[model samples]
Target: MAFKSEYLAKVYASVEKRNPGEAEFLQAVKEVLTSLEPVVAARPDLVKAGVIDRIVEPERFIQFRVSWVDDNGNVQVNRGFRAQFNSAIGPYKGGLRLHPSVCASVIKFLGFEQIFKNSLTGLPMGGGKGGSDFDPKGKSDGEIMRFCQSFMTELCKHIGADTDVPAGDIGVGGREIGFMFGQYKRLRNEFTGVLTGKGLTYGGSLARTEATGYGLCYFTSEMLKCMKNESFKGKTVVISGSGNVAIYATQKATELGGKVVALSDSNGYIYDKNGINLDVVKQIKEVERARISEYAKRVPGSEYHEGCRGIWSIKCDIALPCATQNELNGDEAQMLVKNGVIAVAEGANMPSTPEAVEVFQKNGVMFGPAKAANAGGVATSGLEMSQNSIRYSWTFEEVDKKLNDIMVNIFHSSYDASKKFGSEGDLVMGANIAGFLKVADAMLAQGIAY
Candidate 1:
């Protein structure tokens, strides 16, 4: 199958012209569109209807100036962005990340990935993303609150419950969401489902924080089962990013009898032969907001390495790259294969480079792409929407069970699509085609809104 669609060329050209400096977003779009070449070729309606062109570029891109007073009374200004990429199926739904990496390019890349990720979840939610470059790493509560309030002051005007809803990502957690939502409420004077991932008292869903990580493990478990295996029992696991997703993945894996040997952050990783003490790790990360290297000091017989990339060198039966994109490359994939690693499920969007994916597939290692594995966050966000609409709250166990079922179904869908498209074991292709077809058809039916 060759790229026969001239429309793809035009679309890529348009993307290039529109986004000059956003290399990451362009790369993400190119990777996805390259996979959808066959679909675009077979169904010319997508091109004729401008779906491909429109899909590459976001529907709305918002850039606002967020000026807030720090604790020192010095006004700090940072840029805030919200890229509403698509809303064909439903309202704009995604997370609001606050980190030093937050930029138009990063937000666009994340939002572009979210379009297909939400589609694969089989939920009636569109794709969007919002964030700021304000790092919450060492900020005080007052400073964070002021920054979030200022960020939301402008963002509140554009978003709503059924129009565009935002959750939390990276540095934007329950606390950040609370501050943003409170500001929105103060401005608009309405307490609604304008945001997901809020505190339970403020209309957030149960199990939302743990959903992505648990969902990642559940998706990996399903991937293993599809390869004719059991659960993650007795498997040695290595996880990157000691954030919410990694921590929860560790929690679920340990609960399922898998021993997580390593967990890392931007600063470093801590490896414990006896398995990471997740409780202490949680306290250090969640409560104290400390670096992952601190875990070795609290736990005996553990080694700490200061750098995230070093975590990939550890031997494990399962490797969950729960950090950022392109964290794993061909060499790491080869090393994992040589070390007898059986599975690699991405807990972050496009965590593996193209070469890494090729190496893993060539070696027959079970690889779950981020669109399917990391979909739990958005899927649960959709569930949160459902609960909001129904005015009911599900218990943690109930929500978790449903999340597991959804991940299982997503895996089967990818497996079936791969087999149908002559890439039986390659879920990356399966997920791309399946997700693309869903959104493409929907867009076609909706007609050109722009």
Candidate 2:
């Protein structure tokens, strides 16, 4: 169980009372607050200055209606949101997700998590997240373009290169980013780096697509080496989600001598007794835009399950939940623990429930919280912002090397922070306290108005 100080509990109770029914936001607040008991005890000034209260609340939360016409000439309305959670370090930086599940609660949770994730990267990025409840899965290009244009019409007024920079997440991808960037340029009447995950032809950095996944593996490998004197070599891995994060994680893990046995989409998961072939998976997913079940049809000696959760049932040395929030619950954690799983690293924000996290810790599974493990994508985004400012683009190798170094540093900082706080190896508490101290100190220095 997480340790919450008396003051921290009061702040959390206030957060719950103020934001009723926001389960995702409440869960995120609880997770981070519960980890900060020792920090609060050590530094009473944080409580005196109301840092926890102010940090829990966003600086600005914008919600707007996005009305666009579809291919069938029908006007569709969707809800859009941008929760600029913090700006103590720099501009608000996070990804914009486009999915049916996008909401205020989800955006707030992601934004809150981003504050710490961005801080851990040792970059000058504050935390923010924006998205709409618009599903891009079945939409035509024109429809998506129209929706993006309308969405940005409202979004442009609030964002600038030096203000808020949003990248892609979930249903938002290269095509959607292209559309949104084009619209932002048109509306703002300026060509600037207001968004990331751009095409290489424009102001996009190399290796941005693979940053999050590759970073996750790098962080996990460092954690393994530091805690267990092991690496990813010859380990069997299971990854959920067939999106960019999962695909690239599989690629990097395989490159590091790990055998990724399974990958999943929302519909189901595909298991390969042999190692997964990245090329075929990319072809099916990136080129064909099909589901995970299609891999079983094309690849030999592969099996497809009917549900996404069953992928956890496969025995593996490493498990990376790259899917949406709360996708891996307590039962799944128990299953993985029973199957001799040694490590679980999140590639998605808050993918593991509190109960699942407890199970992993109790069973001696080395756990990497999403904020620390998945900070690579935004770290590279910060690099892209730097490149854009200097009008220079680095090669893929250059960006990747920087990203790998950042992940290694993040792991050590978290490990050392945990040790300093007497937790020794609790990355979850270390990440929370390390990131919170950075932001809290900045906020206190800036005064209460921030």
Candidate 3:
């Protein structure tokens, strides 16, 4: 597709020429740049200042090798990456994912998306992301700790509490964060909020674990109520992924009177026609660290399927893709729209493919882009940073209330922007433009060097 703005076309061409073979990064860049057509047209001074071009490029890219000793005394090696995408708003803040899928392209895509996701939170955070190609599955506690320490030994040099803070993603959790934080403190000889998602015993916020999932439902609920004149009450919801984001989204959706009937992992999906039992799910995924298949084994009347992609085929009123990026594609999206799905909100970063997003847009499925939908975890992380700054903590209810308000405010920001931009109900564009405007304005005020 040809860009309507000549400046955007040139910027994209430069990105493609420079980032050849980086399909994920190129895809993310194209999506956001396309959404900014109206903004570019409305503000030509931004073009003169080169805002679009600069925002597409990272301020710094760091890559390093991490070697650690396994339980067998064999040396294991992995690559680490951190793409500090933008700092127009504040220090870089994002998560460090630990999965075999970690690569330059994946890290760049995530960090680029983080630029907008953090902006939507109305928090003083810029965008950054880091991770390793290390697969943590089936690893022993000692092995995990060794790897984290090795990784953080080098990572500590590039990060500080007020500079760049990274939390957890996919295979990373509190265990990983604790290990890394300990390593950072040892290396830096200082203790601070250099990371979020800390354990309660340390400085982690009360609702940090549940923030992303709960915030997803809160945002989706507002989307349904305002866009479709509907609510989660009596609606059937199918949520993908049984990890942190998926589990809490299920709990909140159920509490809001929605019957969450399905959950999934990379292995497969579980469909409990009798409404999901959140306790059983928490036990299997959280406590046992097992797959969704375990939920079927222990729960009566639940069926376990052998493919994660099949989750989207189930009939439902709402769908939340809390799994990995591009987990839901055009065919799966068609299935949902065909099966009477009324709303689709992302709980994972860029979970829906472009073709899938097109399907939702064409069918008027009340789409909520991941930037706006999944800003909760980071919002709470921002809150965690606040608590850490004051050397204090807020009660669970207080954090929960603040998270709710933030989600609500994010909804209105996206909704109002969509309407103002003459694309009412098109949250993908709304979120992209709303987030970019803040960062772009900041860049402009700070001069072209930014």
| Counted clashes in each candidate structure | 0, 0, 0
Clashing pairs in 2: none
Clashes of 1: 0
Model 3: what TM-score?
A: 0.99
Ranking by lDDT: 3, 2, 1
Candidate 3 ranges with C-alpha deviation above 4 Å: none
Estimated TM-score for each candidate: 0.97, 0.99, 0.99
Q: Comparing candidate 1 with candidate 2, which one achieves the higher lDDT?
A: 2
Candidate 1 lDDT tens digits, 151-238:
9999998999999999998888899888998999999988889999989997889999999999999999988876857679999999
Tell me the lDDT of model 2 at 211: 98
- Name the regions of candidate 2 deviating beyond 4 angstroms: 1-4
- Provide the lowest-lDDT 10-residue window in model 1: 1-10
Q: Assess candidate 2 and give its lDDT.
A: 0.94
Better of 1 and 3 by TM-score: 3
TM-score, prediction 2: 0.99
Scanning candidate 2 in windows of ten residues, the lowest lDDT window is 1-10
Model 3 Cα lDDT, one tens digit per residue, 381-425 = 999999999999999999999999999989999989888888998
User: Model 2: per-residue lDDT, tens digit, 1-450?
Assistant: 444587888898899899999999999999999889889989999899999999999999999999999998999999999999999999999999999999999999999999999999999999999999999988888999999999999999999999999999998888999999999998778999999999999999999999999999999999999999999998999999999999999999999999999999989999998999889999999998988898999999999999999999999999999998999999999999999999999999999999999999988999999999999999999999999999999999999999999999999989899999999889999999899999999999999776
